[model samples]
Target: MTPSHRSDLLTDALLHYSKKVERKQITLLPQRLAKAAKVKEEARAEFTALLQSVPGTTITAVRGWGEDLVNSLEKTSISLSWEEAYVENLHQLELGRTQLEAPRGGAQVLEVVKRTERARRQVDILERRHRVRQRWSLTTTDSERYLTAAMEKRAQAVLDSVSNLAFERKFMCGLMAKYAEGQTIAKKLSRQIHKLNSKIRRNVKLYNLKRPVIPSSSTLPTLMTFEIAMNPESGLWSQHSVSHDAAFQLKQRLFVLLSLHDRASEEMNIIKRPVCRVRED
Candidate 1:
C-alpha cells in the first residue's frame, strides 16, 4: 500500500478509536472536575486554618478608634460656630481639649483615648493586645518586625500551595499526552498485525511448499502451523490481535493514572510549615 493510503487508513481507524476514548473522557469529565474541586477546597481550608492559627490578625480594630475619637471630642467638646449653645458647651469643649498628660485629666476617657492612640501606632498590637490600658499606655513600633516576619512566612506557604496546584495541572497534561500517544501506538500495532496475517494467508505457498495454505484470519502470531494445517484454528485471529492491543493499551492507561496519583501525593509537601527550632538541621 502507498504511504498515503496507510496514513488515510490509520487516520480513519484513529478517528473511530479516538471517538471511543473521547466518549470515555466525556463520562470521566465530571469525575475529574469533582476531584479537582475537592483538592482546591481542601487547600483553601488549610489556608484558612493557617490564617486563624497565627497569633494576631491582619484586620485591625479601627472602629473602636473612631468611637474613641468621637467620645473625646464630645467630652472636651469643641462646637461649630453656627451652634446656639450654653456656657456648659464651652466648658465641655475646653475639658475635651485638655491634654491626656495634664494633671487633672487622668479620667477614664482620657486614659482610654491614650491607649487607643498607642494601639493605633501598630495594627498588630491592636490585634494581639486585648488590654486597652494600665498604669501607663506604652507602645514600640519595634514590635512591627516580628509581625512582618511571621506574616511573610505564612504568605510563602500559601504561595507554595498555589505553585503545587499549578504543577499538578501540568503533570496531568503529561498524563493526557501519554494516553494519547499510547492509543496511537496501539492502533498502529493492531493494523500491523492484521496486515501481517493477511499477507501470510495469501503467500503461505510461496514461503513453504510442504505446508498447507492458511486462511487470512487464522494466521495469528500465537497460532501453530499444525493447527492451521489441520484446520483447528478458528478465524478469530484479528479479534485476538485486537484484544492483545487493547490489553497493552490498558497498561499504558494505568501508567498515566499513576503519574496523576504521584501529583496528589506530593501536594502535602507544599502546604506544610516548619515549627520553631532551637537548632538548624
Candidate 2:
C-alpha cells in the first residue's frame, strides 16, 4: 500500500474509535447522573433523620447538609414558648411579693413599733447625757460644776428607770424570731425565683435557636436574670406594690436588729455565738 493511503486508513480507524467511545459515554451519562443523585438524596435524608432522632443535638457541631431542616425541627420541638415562660415568671414574682407583703399579727407589730419608739427615745437621752458631760468638762465655776453633776446624776437615774434589761432582752428575742421567719420566707422565695429564671432561660434559648428573620417589633425585651431581679438598685422593686416595698424595708430592719443582737450578745458574754441555720441573703 502507498504511505498516503496507510495514513488515511489510520486516521479513519482513529475517528471510528473516537465516535464509538463518545457514543458509549453518552449512553452511560444518565445512569451515572442518577446514581450520583440517589447518593445525594440518601445522604440528605439520613442526616435529616439523625437530626430528628436527636432534637437536642447542638447545631454548631453538625457539619452537613440540611441545616435548614435541623432548624425547622428545633423550632417545632420547643414545648414552651418564651412569652409563656416570661408570663409565668412574672406571676411567680408577684406571688412572692404578696407573701412578703401580707400582714403579720397586729399585737406583735404594735409591740415592735412601740419598742422601736422607746429605743429612739433612749438614744436621744444618751445623746443629751453625752452633751452634758462635754459641757461639764468646759465649766469653770464650782456652782456650774455642781449643777452639771446634779444634771448628770438625774440623767443617770432617768436612764436607769428607762433602760429595762429584761424588756430589752425580750425585744431582742422578738427581733431574732422575726428575723428567722423572714429569712425562711426569703430563702424559699429566692429558690423559687431561681428555678423560674432557669426555666425562662431554657425556654428562651430553645425558642431563639436557629430562628430565622425575627422582626424588630416582634422581638421581646431582654428579661432580667435572677441576680439582676434580686438587686435593690435594679429598679425592679419600684414596679411592685407599696406592700412589697414595706416588706423589703422590714427585712432590712430585721437584719440590722439581728446584727445588733449578735453584737450585744457578744459584748455581754451571756450567750455563745449563735449558729446560723440559713445561708446569708
Candidate 3:
C-alpha cells in the first residue's frame, strides 16, 4: 500500500523475471562451436598474414588478385566473428540476469544486455555484407573492376567501403531511434516531476490555510514505477531509487538515459566523408 511495499513487490517480480532470463541465456550450444570458432579465427589471421608473401601485390594486375585473397580472409573473419559473438553475448546475458537479481543492479545489467544485443545486430549486418559481396563478386565486369581500382587503388576498396558505410548508416539509424525514445522519456519524466512539485506546493498552501484535508489512500510513488516506465527502453534501468537508502530511482535513470540520448545525438550529427567516385574516361 506504501511506496516501500510497492518496491518490495516489484523487486520480487524482477527477480523472477531475471531468473527466467538466466535460464534462457544458459541454453548451451554444442561444445564444438567454441573450438570451431577459435580455429576459424586463427586460420583467417594466418591467411591474412600470408598476404605479405604474395608478390606484386602493389601492381594493378596482381592487386586485384591480392584483393580477392584479402577479401576471402575478411569474409571468413566476418563469418567466424559473427558466429563467435554469440558466445560472449549469452555469457554476458547470464551475467546481466544475475546482476539484475541483485539489489540496485539494474542499471549495469541493462547496459550489458543491451550491448550484447547491439553486438548481435552488428553480426547480422556482417552476415548480410558477406552475402552481398558473394553476389557482386560473381557479377563484376572488367570495366567495373578497372573503375574500382582507379577510384581506390584496390579493386575491393569500393565494395569494402560501401559495406562499411551501409553498416555505419544502419548503426546511426538505430542510435537515432534510441535517442528519440530517450527524448520522449525525458520529457515525460520532466512533466511528471513538475506536476509532483505543483501538487506539493498546493498541499502546503492548503495546510497553511488551516483547512482540513483528507489524504488520498493511493500508494505513494516508488522506484518500481521507473522500472515500469523503462520496460520498453530495456537498457541500463534501475528499479531502485538513487539514495543512501533507495526511494526514487527514476531520476537517476532519467539522468543516465538523457546523457545517452545526447551522446547518440552528437554521433548522429557528425558529417560523413563522401563516397569514392570514378571519373568518366
Candidate 4:
C-alpha cells in the first residue's frame, strides 16, 4: 500500500478504536457502579448485623446509637439513589424535547416525513440565528423554553440533594468509625459476662450460699448478680453499658456469696483472706 493509504488506514483504525472505547465505557461504567453499590450494601448489612448481634444488655446506649446511625446511612443512600433517578429522567426528557417537532401537513409522503422536514427547517433557522454546532436541536416555543428552564432548575436541585446525601453518608461513616472502639469493648465484655454467668450458675449452687427458699417467689441472688454484673449505674458501665467495672462488680458480689458459704462450711481458712480485694500500686 501507498504511504497515504497507510495513513488513512491508521486514521480509520484510530476512529474505530475510539468508538469501541466509548461504547465500552458506556457499558462498563453503569455495571461497575452497580457492583460497587451492591458491595457497599452488603458491607452495610454486615455492619448492621454486627451491631444487632452485640448483646443489647451489654451496649444498650451504644447499640442504640449505632443502629440509629445505620438507619440514617440507609436513608441517605436511598434518597441519593432517588435523586439520581430523577436527574436521569429529567435529562432524558430534555433530550427528548430537543429531538421532537410539531406535526406537519397530511401529504402523500406521510406526517412523519413532514415533521422531519419541519424539524430540519427549525434547526436551520436556529443555526443561522444562534450559530449553533452541527447536530444541534432546539425547541422555539415559550412553553418549551419554560419547561427546559424548569428541568434545569430541577437538575440543580437534584445535584444539591446528591451533595447533601453524600455529606450525610460521610458523617454516618465517621460516627460509626468513632464508636467502633466502644463497640469492640462492649462485645468483648459481653462475651466475658456470658462465660462468667455460666461459671457462676455451675459453681454458685455448689456452695450452701443461702438458697432462696420458695425459689418461685424469690429471685436467685446468684442469678441477680448477673444484673449487677451489667452495672448500668456506674459511669463507665452506663456510658458503654458494658465494661471492666461491671465485671469487677459481679466478681465482688460473687466473692461475698462465696465468703458466706465459706463461713457456713466452717472453712475458716478461706474466710481468713479478704473476700475480694483490688491491689494498689
TM-score of each: 0.21, 0.21, 0.18, 0.20
Residue lDDT tens for model 4, 208-250: 2323211333222222332332333523224322322434333
Give candidate 2's total backbone clashes: 0
- The local distance difference test score of model 4 is 0.41
**How well is each residue in 1-281 modelled by candidate 1, as lDDT tens digits?**
99999999999999999778766655565455556556656545544454364355332322333344334223133232211121122222333446444555347766656654543444334333544243121123322333333333333332223222222333344435534556876556555545544443433333242112222332333223422422212343333223223333333333333334445445433322111111121
**Candidate 4 — which residues are off by over 4 angstroms?**
55-281
Q: What ranking emerges by TM-score with the best candidate at the front? A: 2, 1, 4, 3
Clashing pairs in 3: 241-248, 241-249
Ranking by lDDT: 4, 2, 1, 3
What is the TM-score of candidate 1? Answer: 0.21
Candidate 2 lDDT, 1-281, residue by residue in tens:
99999999999999999878766655454455455455445545554554565555534434322343233223222233332222223333434445446686877656555655554454345446445343122234543334334333333332222222112232344444544546876566555545544544443343333122223332222233434333434453354223234433333333343334444434433211111111111
Against the reference, the lDDT scores of all candidates come to: 0.38, 0.40, 0.38, 0.41
Q: Report the poorest 10 consecutive residues by lDDT, candidate 2.
A: 272-281
Q: Each prediction's Cα RMSD?
A: 38.7, 36.5, 34.7, 32.7
Q: How would you encode candidate 3's per-residue C-alpha lDDT over 1-281 as one tens digit per residue? A: 99999999999999999768645434322223344444445544544454345443333433344344345325322222422343333334445566657766667767766866775565456547555343222124542333222322221222233232222233334445544556876566555545544443443343322211112321222112222322322221222121211211222222333334444444333311111111111
lDDT score of residue 18 within candidate 2? 80
Better of 1 and 3 by TM-score: 1
Residue 58 miss distance in model 2 (angstroms):
6.6
